[model samples]
Target: MATAYWKGANTKTGGGFWSSGHTPTLIAAFLYFDLAFMVWVLLGPLAPAISKALALTPAEKGFMVATPTLAGALLRVVNGLLVDRIGPKRSGAISQLIVIGGLLSAYLLGVDSFGGTIALGVILGFAGASFAIALPLASRWYPPDHQGKAMGVAGMGNSGTVLASLFAPGLAKLFGWNTVLGLACIPLAIVFVIYMAMAKDAPGRPAPKSLSEYLHPLKSADAWWLMGFYSVTFGGFVGLAASLPIYFTDRFGLTPITAGYCTAACVFAGSLVRPIGGALADSIGGIKMLIGVFIVAALALAAVSIAPTVGSALAFFVVAMLALGVGNGSVFQLVPQRFGAEIGVMTGLVGMAGGIGGFYLASSLGLAKQWTGSFAPGFLIFAALALVALVSVFVVKSQWRRSWGAAEGVRI
Candidate 1:
């Protein structure tokens, strides 16, 4: 197979599918992942509405929202390895089909019973696995020099949470939650078809490694460090995305619609700005970007911990979430710099860690709210973790700079 590369003016070089530049493929991949993410996070924004109808307790509500995240986190490693073996395009399409099935099943299950909702939540997690496929797909399309931007663009699909938060509640109100869930299938179906028809695997890629080679990164200290960084960054972003609606409604006396919109706004800022964060890291340095984001995130989370009013709390939450989003992009930028060759396996592992982080944060918030009747403890705990992450990054900065051989990393 011939590799695709840019040609001189007026020249068409290669016959490979990506010879025209990767923008279209990137966009298609983004849409596919975005729809998956939207479905994966549907329960969070829909939780308040479903709970009102079901009279669910706080702990049950948290479990309902967090189950998909937990499932997704666990499934990412499986999807990542599948992508490496079958190629990203095929893996992504298959994931989307699975997501469509999950959504349809969730719709059929309805919101009548807690057990039904939990079952659906677990199934929807397959949407979360789309992360493994989309990120690697975009990364493979561009050369290593352009990976920050490519991955950033693909990652912007995480903004899909914004769409779910913004619309799912209102749609549920108008047509019922089950109908809203069923409607989600429309977008997924369309994206799945388009991706299948137009997308192609990256050309001239090497054959996948043996299972042992793929798993070897697990034994490396750097892999664990990257996992920690991702757990804080991407994990925080996802956790907040899954919990914000419940937090707003329970703590502030807001209506489900209002809470959903607020949650959507928070997700929007984080998701849309993620690419910019990657670009910034590319131009400056990933270490500097990570340090700055972590500091701001800690301060913001601390402010939320002490906020006297709902408005102040919301403001702090928004800021903290945005910083976490940027940190998500920056951490991945650094990951490739330090471990480019091991990206597939490392992505699976680190992505899993991030997913677990999200699950813990969301569940912990629920537990705190249930036991103490306040989210302050949860906020403070995450703030402390952010501070530790900040110090850890600074401590490792010199080593990363020497090993990566770039003054600064690539800006997305």
Candidate 2:
């Protein structure tokens, strides 16, 4: 019975007030994550434009789009170390500067060919590393009961990708893609100034730990589980965000602007639902919420795999992305519960997994299209993995309730 599975799961422990003091850090983290996400996923909407300019084949397009995701995965570990050592504020500023420099170099110097775009994508990975910096930055300020709400608010910065999808193609049409890249640096520069001036590391933050201690969470099985779970949720959300422009254009013969609009709608659905997901998890249980999320997402993916109409396919994608967004929120809500002491490091480790998952999905869709001339196989494969997550959650939930959920001041 559902009741049996969720026994003691509804239990709440400590209650934390959302006083006005925590607002700036939360807003700063959101801005950092949002603008970074905008820049991180820029290549997706720009892929069609760059492909036309550079004469990139389908596989080349996929590789270019997926490069940032994979590169971000590797850089996340390094940023995680910096976040642990130098603090999120400093680490984040350094990362923002690197990303800004890279963008300026690309804009002024120019990307003349496919290889240049790939190199540019690598620099864009710094934007993606904001994931490692922002979550821990926000998590440190709030208490456990407010963990879900706070992280969810920060994670909404992912809606930045929506801005990219909405505007990148049109601006590229009007001003040239290079100019768009140059213009992107402006918002980032402003954000960096704001973030530096406003965001601060928590007082009484733990002393910098050794490399081994920073990675100690990896020694736990639960850490691996969280990584796996986030790999799917965040992976699906971002992978689709990066790929949907191409998918809409290829599948439906839509223009880049129209496709961007479609992609933006889907991204908006996912981004808008995230905070609701976190709040829901806070009330019932993340374990239970994730179970529903995996199931809904798997079903949605499977349905989209065979969808015959543009409207039908998009409808499924909206549902799947919504579920994935909820899953992203639920996973983090549980993270602070199990590893509050290690949230900084865990955010990077788990965030790396999410980036890797996104890389795989984005690349696989291209490969699937190149090799098989259809995207159904990729959707089917991921649906199977979602089911794997669903089953894994069933086994893990009972144990979590009896252990972490039973703790006096932690919400499971």
Candidate 3:
């Protein structure tokens, strides 16, 4: 009965593109996420320009990009609570309003100092929290059989970074960087109206969870495993998205526009392939897919850390981002499989872990460059972490396949 309510049609897992779930909400979720993601990673491509204006150090630049990630991490959990309590519609609207106000303030006041930029990053963190709100908003509307496709379509909004890397610098070039914030508000406002009109709460949402109920999952080992794996996949994906502009500029002496172009190309590899990853995971097992993802990402990150010549670096990042993007989808495939009833809470927890991973990588890259005169150390460390996650996955695979995962109808 619950499944029938979630699946409005004869939609099956391999059905046509629009074969499953609430199409209107999925579209709204993606739009909301796409715009939210742009603002979330805004400071990354703009970091070089802002650093020039503020005279910030490498470490300062890193924090400038990382602050939003960390703030967003914390906010994801809060947004999760709000989703269960006030519902995704209200929570998303409020979060969007706060982010809109922040952008408006940045545009009108003009960020003059490093501190001001940091404050803006904090505001941008709310945009990052869109992950928690938007995923559940889309996921609850779909049946388990088609969860991957629905979530992937919504999750592809992570590609919002591509839009940021491609256009923000150009817009900044035409109008002052600060004014870019005001301009950002235009698109955000438009999405806000559209999302409000189109999106709705699903019929089969779980009861609003109490704090203890939400926290209870933390007691389980599987929860931690999902968190660790996501930290690497999503963390690495977004951290790179935010920090690549700085790396390109500092390493190759590219203009902000050029850096943005390269970043956009690499991120496009990630964004476009996410749905493919989800579909693939649906076809194969998520764990089997993730092992390969971590291996590719580890190798690619290692190559990029060398800060090779322009061509080699771009190629390496292109592969690295693609692997990480697939990993992001693969991890979510398991999330609903492992924690179906607690999907909202688990999304927040796992998503926050991913944000924290991004925060660490982004900041560490800045610090690594500052301390060693190269980004190699940070890349090496994360590569090792990826390897660790690989080993951890190997350890958990049997346990998961033998337990609750066995009951999950979709591939696990």
Candidate 4:
């Protein structure tokens, strides 16, 4: 199919188009991913207002924020498979349309009831699954040597949370939360149309994997290890991004606007730094970057646990987000090196792990607040988990190095 497309393009344009990079394709994919991410994280900015209005318990509040993440995780595998069957361009446009519908439905339902909020959250998660399609779409368009930068650029769409964190609360405050949600649909609708018009699958690539080949990676230990690493890195980044506004409001008595600003800073720092992280990984190696990121993240989380004032809390949050962002880049760096051919399936599994981790982190914070009347325990727990991940990374590093070298030498 890709060969056919390439031939068609060559015949039409006399080969000039083939020499140009796929910049338009990359841009369209990035926009699609960004919109999905914004919707995926809607609950974070709205949590304080929604919880207070509904009189929700802390655990309930946590679950409300986590529902979309859980749903998104489960949908990633389905989306990954669908991308091959339908192509990223079609899948992205359709997914965005679905997200627009979901946002509209949530706006109409009005987040007044616990069940209603959870249902809305599930719809938002469907939007988040767009990641499975967007990342691979961008990667396939680039040459192998450029995959890291391409993926990094495309993955920056995750920064969409920064916009949500920065503005959603203010919007909700100005127009009422429901109206703000209804407004989100406008962008989704526009982006959906633009993506459909511009995005296309890469030309001259192999057909997508067979069902059996796609399933084969599931039995590999390396795949699961990568998932575990991502669960700690990308997972931590997303979980914290989605939960920060609520955490600030609950712990510091901050207003919704103030909380949104703080969360925005954290998310923006992480998202903007992702490309840098990828570049650093290319230079210094993924294992070293992962080691440093884990250490920094653990210390930052511990610092947050003991932070006594809003300034101190914000400082720790920024540091933690930076570390997690770097770790996210390192994890993906190692992923393609280890699972090049199985990229789609492995992305689904690893992406799901990250989503599940976000769900766990959000729920745990809520549980700690409700059960113990403090968030310190939750912070400590996350720090401890980072420590475990650090150890796991070290244990796997030597094995991966040897295996990768042997495989490359054999290919040569």
Q: Rate the local accuracy (lDDT) of all candidates.
A: 0.80, 0.87, 0.89, 0.80
TM-score between candidate 3 and the true structure:
0.96
What is the C-alpha local distance difference test score of candidate 1? 0.80
How well is each residue in 270-292 modelled by candidate 3, as lDDT tens digits?
Answer: 98888778878878978998999
Candidate 4 error regions (>4 Å) = 1-21, 208-210, 405-412
Query: Cα deviation in Å at residue 165, candidate 1?
Result: 0.5
Candidate 4, residues 1-412, lDDT tens digits: the string is 0112222222232223224347778888889888889989998899998888899899999999989998998888888777766677777777787888878877786667999889889889888888788887776665433445667778889899998998899998999888888999988888887888778787654477778776787888877887888888777888888888889998988999999999999998888877677767766677888899999999999999999999999999899999998877777766666665656666777888889888889889889999999988988998898999999988888877777724532110
By TM-score, the best candidate is 3
Worst 10 residues of 1 by lDDT: 1-10
Candidate 2 local distance difference test against the native: 0.87
| 114-233: candidate 1 lDDT, tens digit per residue | 888888888888898788888877666665455566778889999899889999999988998889989999988988888877666666554688888778777877778888988888
Using lDDT, rank the candidates from best to worst. Answer: 3, 2, 1, 4
Model 4, position 201: C-alpha lDDT score: 81
Model 2 regions more than 4 Å off:
1-17
Best by lDDT: 3
**Candidate 1 residue pairs in clash (backbone atoms < 3 Å):** 278-412, 279-411, 279-412, 282-410, 282-411, 283-411
